[model samples]
Target: MHGLIGQLRTTPGGRGEVVAALVEGARDMPGNLVYLVAEDAEDPTSIWVTEVWETEAAHRASLDLPSVRAAIARARPHLTGMGTRVVTRPVASLGA
Candidate 1:
C-alpha cells in the first residue's frame, strides 16, 4: 500500500478551517483508504494526518484536479508549517 503522513502547525484560529478542509478531502477523494488525525492537547491547531492510499499514482493524480487544489487551499490560511512523506510498504494482511 502507499501512504502519506503529514504534520502541521496551525496558526491561531486555523484548526476549524483545517478540519473542514480535511473533511472535504475525505468526501472528494476516490482512492483513499483513510485519513487519521492526531491533535496536540496544548494546542488545538497542532495536528497530524496519516493518510492511506491504494496507490501513490492515484494520490498524485488527485493533485492535478482543481477540486483538490481548492481543498488544499482551504487549509493554507491556517497552516504555519507542514510536511508530507510518501511511503510504499508491503501488505501483510487485509487489515492494512
Candidate 2:
C-alpha cells in the first residue's frame, strides 16, 4: 500500500475551513483506503493529513478529481505554507 503524511500551515483562524475542504474532497476517492485529516495539537494554524491508497498512481490520480480540485481551490487562499511531507510504504494497518 502507498501512504502519505503531510502538514499544512494555514492563515490565522483558517484551519477549520481548510480541514473541512480537505475532508469533503477526500470522499469516494478511488483506491483510497484512508484519508484522515487532523488538527495539529500544538499549532492552531496547522493541519495534518494522512492518506493511504492502493497504489501511488491512485494517490496521484486523486489530484485530478473534481472534488479534489475544488478543495484545492477553496484551501489555497487560506494556505500560508507547507510543512513535512513523507512518502511511505504501508506494510501494516490496525484493521487490515
lDDT of each: 0.75, 0.95
Q: Give the TM-score of candidate 2.
A: 0.97
Stretches > 4 Å off in candidate 1: 83-96
Q: Could you say which candidate leads in TM-score?
A: 2
Per-model C-alpha RMSD:
2.7, 1.1
Task: Write the residue-wise lDDT of candidate 2 on 1-96 in tens digits.
Answer: 999999999999999999999998998999999998999999999999999999999999999999999999999999998999999998988963
Clashes of 2: 0
TM-score of 1: 0.77
TM-scores of all models?
A: 0.77, 0.97
